[model samples]
Target: MILKKIIEMKKVLVINSSARTLRSHSRKLTEVFVNHWKTTHNNSHITFRDLGTENVPHINENWIAAAFKPETERTGEEKEALKISDIYISELHQADIIVLGTPMYNWSIPSVLKAYIDQVVRVNQTWKLNPENLKNPYIGLLENKTLFVLLSRGAEGYGKGEYNEHMNFQSDYLKTVFNIMGVHNIHVVAIDGTSFDPEILKQTIQNSHQNVKSLIEKELA
Candidate 1:
């Protein structure tokens, strides 16, 4: 038998998009951030999901049909699709904070995260349209939520105004999508130059760590 305990836990959801194991730099940054966050926010609970390893199926016709079907009339198959998506959305709802361990792949987020997003972003679930104001759209499910994105890249200087900045669709796209879901505050911490000099990569990681620490301090204040 499994023991069930009840306590006030500040749920934190961490998604790994690298499709690799803990060896990935993005994963490394996420782990460090979570560890420090846990220490700072003692007694808080955390749930970690490896999106890369979750084997979440790509969205298909059946999934779409189920997601759109009215709750009262949904069939067993439809319920199953909803159940899968509910698991993801439940975590988001429970979470007080979210951390996405993302790595730039071809200047975009990984397919796994995309698949997960498809599962979670359901109409009338995470958001809904306003009939009165057809021209005005609003989403409030995840309002006031905070998100931290830890990104890694093999190349260097992908920050703003860099030659490769325009190629960085990962952070910008994430911001837009999450914003649509009503997540207002988002932070991006990048560990670039991984494929370059070892010294530079080490320094970048250290600097990011400091930045995250300061952010946490500010948030707690």
Candidate 2:
């Protein structure tokens, strides 16, 4: 008899932050990525978070106090305040790969996604602040994770050195935020010109789907 080693399955977290449901291009991108990933990683565990429909409350002063205060010393109200944040953080911690799909709203991310970001980027949880080094204070805690940013834009030319590069706040902001959380292995795929002609939009979406498939093969291989 021959002994074989069994490999553990990876955990993937998928976040969708588009306001549109049936008509959301970003959601379509995520669906494509998830389907392809499933085909490649048959046994992988996937967790889905739909910020478009689900309401992730914006962090208030109570949340700030709860997050900043020591866990042992937190009051009942403070603990309650951080309940949602804790849940979001737990999901992030368990995920080996994160897939974020969102449309560029007003040249940036949706407010709901921003709220989710605020919830997860907690001090002493996702990252730490080095007091001695003011210049380089942020120390990310969630290390060795892969992030896939699938973006949908109404207009084109948002890549590096592109015509509308300066106007792109979506990709850069997301990359920076995840980088701060210690996710260095990042892959971005954007489906641009969503507001173009029907045929052009369809082609662009197809290209993005192919790109996602290629990326999965290349990155996961």
- What TM-score, computed on C-alpha atoms, does each candidate reach? 0.90, 0.94
* Model 2 lDDT, residue 133, Cα: 93
lDDT of 2: 0.90
Regions more than 4 Å wrong, model 1: 1-9, 131-136
CA RMSD for every model?
4.7, 2.3
- Top candidate by lDDT: 2
Q: Choose the strongest candidate by TM-score.
A: 2
In the range 1-221, model 2's lDDT, one tens digit per residue, is 11111112778899999999998989998999899887776577899999999989999888888887789988898899899999999999999889999999999999999999999999989999999998878999998788999999999999999999999999999999999888999999999999888899888889999999998887754
What does candidate 1's lDDT look like per residue over 40-81, in tens digits?
Answer: 775677889898887887877777898787888888887877
Give candidate 2 misplaced runs (Cα > 4 Å): 1-8
The local distance difference test score of each candidate is 0.81, 0.90
Clashes of each: 0, 0
Residue 171 Cα positional deviation in candidate 2, in Å, after optimal superposition: 0.5
